[model samples]
Target: IQLRAMIRWGLETVHRSLAPWCSVDSIARHLVEQTESLLLQLSDVRPLAPNKSALNHLLATAGWLTPPLVDGLQALGWLIDERGLAGTAATDGLAWCLPMHELFERWVEHLVRLWAYPFGGHVRSGRTFETLVPIRWSSAAPKSLKSLVPDVVVELGSQTWVFDAKYKNHFEELDDQAWFELAEEIQSEHRHDMHQALAYAATCPASQIITVLVYPMRLPVWERLTARGRSVTVAEVLGGDRSVQVALAGVPIQLSHPEQTNQIVAAWNPLFSVGQ
Candidate 1:
């Protein structure tokens, strides 16, 4: 229900902005036409065997496609073309529309603020909250790192958290070789995340540096990693429900629904208060 309402609101908002130049119905019709055309073009080409010309055409049509959105759409297209779209995995894979997903997430947060208990008697938004807040690691770095900008960064508060968002299908099980390879890959990535977060925390002495791995909840096991006194926590969040399964130091909690996230924020408030 909330998702549908958000989609409608997004369409309405777009229509309103363009209303002065065109009628709402006309604007909507044009959007539909464009989307259908794009889908048709996309349908003809398999991403694995994508022809350069076809990719160019699709790209030209999707002018508003941001990097993350492009990544998401390509990921979805791959999943659909390879795996028949008829299961929990497919449903979860289709839920990656980038900024649209982000909008829905924020909406959930808004609903939580209105209906749920406050995280710390004050719901943090914008740059006020530790996780949402941005920090500059190198004083001389060309630009201040922004969360919206999208790159690996450690969020510092009472504890230092290294955070990254993985938008991929979850694994149910793996054989021994696959398990070893997977573990090695994750360990390397986790170490890199830790180094970056630790670098950020060096500037802020009071904070304890921690690392977190955030992946779709379908993946099993949330393990803890410790190297040289730094801690890394791995958590699995449900892709469909967006419910957070684990919370760890050195990681920002990314939830599927805002209401559920608000509950998480409320839970974290006490820890924050005591740590502060």
Candidate 2:
């Protein structure tokens, strides 16, 4: 398997060719070019045209880890419509697409870990196999759910924060609405998120648990919510000894200012304090 060469070439190709498809026009041109200089030294490895056939071949032969690397290429806009690989009508050849939920999870994990370090605790993530809990299925079927992995986990003394990042607009559409005001579909999905958070809390052993259901919010909207003291909604659940706190919060995804993200994360201190 030429997996090593393939991944290096793919990264360089993305930095060189498809970078424009996803580059933000608002960023300074010089800075963007400077970022390109940070690419891995791939002088000997020739560029690979990330076609579906080639990526598929690698996936079929390159053991288990090839999928994520191939996926990174797709995220970089190299897998455009029928031109590169077969895709649904969403691409439209001109538009760039990515699994925003996955991206949001990584962003949240990074931000949370930065703040978590001050607590003198270990930070873990599903991305690194740090928080993956194996499921014991009595009679496993073909392609059953493998593990219950919390997006981000932080351990602090007897308390733990299990964050589940969801990149949904449900807060804008469903938050503050009456139960009857929400559509059946939105209601169902919101409940599903809450249920999943509960499952994570149950699986993870902690005397005091904070199960955070985080969603993506625009910078302006997050600011508005913060002003009203509603950015982080804290609901104390499981009253007695095993105290569980269910937090419904939104994180600013497209951050405009540096302190804006810091402010959003700082609001979480109150929830962290609850466990202490």
Candidate 3:
């Protein structure tokens, strides 16, 4: 119940923060999608029986509860309503809408709290790097290459770590060809992403370049790979365990979805740290 409340609070905060830039409808829809995903993931984990008193309290003053969870419930209710109103224009059609800056920012925050930092002690002082910073990577030459965007970027001591979010089931060992292909693709598009991070390391010249990939637990044991003199550590974020923390280049990277995050962070951490 406490965990649910905390999750609800985090979501509501995100919704409120994003409401200024995006419509309540759009935000509600996004929240609903995320909530459904979360619920589906948790379906296997037995939910603690709802406390009757708490249920009554929630029902009486649903408004008083945090906005994200309230918005989530509202979104769920809206989905139910939409199903009833199917075939009517009242239901918003599926569209790939560009998320507003505020919405994106809030989403990032929610992700950090709900997916990145689930363990209490992983983040010291409960601080996370701001999401609105104007960090840009050099344009990639090969247009076909996909530039990776890490979920969280952490600066620890003199190093900056890029943590990418991968919401996959688990980490699989990549063969040499696979790693080479991925590295080749990354180098082709955003040639400077790694270099820029290394340059940024001048100020905090990271001892390591970390990429934290977020993956769902319940697959296999996390694997660690070292290739081209770079190290990649794959860690698992079990669905049942909420508090999981791993270190990349000495910086603590915590994730609610540890399996994926660990792989990402591990892959990038060594790039900057090896020779430093």
Compared with the true structure, all predictions reach lDDT values of 0.37, 0.71, 0.38
Compare the candidates by TM-score and give the number of the best one: 2
Candidate 1 — worst ten consecutive residues by lDDT sum? Answer: 218-227
Candidate 2 lDDT, 134-242, residue by residue in tens:
8877775565777899998999778888999998887766556777899999989999999999989988788889899989877888888888888888888855668
Give the winner by lDDT.
Answer: 2
Higher-lDDT candidate among 1 and 3? 3
Give the candidate order by descending lDDT: 2, 3, 1
The CA lDDT at 146 in model 2 is: 74
Over all chains combined, what TM-score does candidate 2 have?
A: 0.64
Tens digits of lDDT, candidate 1, 189-261? 6456445543443443333432233333221121121122122233443343222223233212343332343
Residue-level lDDT for 196 in candidate 3? 37
Q: What stretches of model 2 exceed 4 Å from their correct place?
A: 1-97, 139-144, 239-241
lDDT of 2: 0.71
Better of 2 and 3 by TM-score: 2
Q: Residue 85 of model 3: what lDDT?
A: 16
Clashes of each: 9, 0, 27
